[model samples]
Target: MADRPVPVKDLKLLDIKLGQLPGWLASRNYSPMGFVNGYRRGYNRFYSKYIDVKKGGIGGIAMLLTGYVLISYIWNYDHIKHERWRRYH
Candidate 1:
């Protein structure tokens, strides 16, 4: 199961946008549907150009795992530092 390839349409990689709410709303002329569709169009374009079902899933999983480890390490370091500070102070 782990080696099974995912369908391209099901892989939602980097499909999110941030800080574009204001611009997207303005571009839509205050229409929610237009703004949402514009994002969908962009995401579709990105997926079509860069993402392949055969390759994307494995890469995405690897990236996610790497990111998780990195985040965990940083969070643990911060918590350890905080605990040491509290213990001594």
Candidate 2:
């Protein structure tokens, strides 16, 4: 449990709204099974929540990446400032 990044129960909650993909596609006159990807069905089922724009799927990933990058910048800034401070003093 200590080594696992996410629990099975938590992962199970990630199951969301994949059941509606086919109906949505059908309303638009598209076949759900017509997609070229062989694993599209499975992917659609698993990643439906992550693909929802309203759920912040891609945007959330980008914001998280940006936050970590800024944290890294802050961490490195002290070292650079220390070097400059030494040079000036």
**Which candidate number maximizes lDDT?**
1
Worst 10 residues of 2 by lDDT: 7-16
Estimate the TM-score for candidate 1: 0.31
TM-score of each: 0.31, 0.29
- Return the clash pairs for model 1, or none: none
Query: Which pairs of residues collide in candidate 2?
Result: none
Residue-wise lDDT of candidate 2 within 1-82, one digit each (tens)?
A: 5775643323332442577555444443235555444357556654554555554646656755787999998999988788
Q: Which portions of model 1 show Cα errors greater than 4 Å?
A: 1-28, 53-89
lDDT of 1: 0.61
Error of 2 at 83 (Å): 4.5
Per-residue lDDT value at 65 in model 2: 76
Give one digit per residue, the lDDT tens place, for model 1 in 1-89.
58896544344444425554444434443479867886898767656655646555555557557879999989799777887778542
* Total backbone collisions for each predicted model: 0, 0
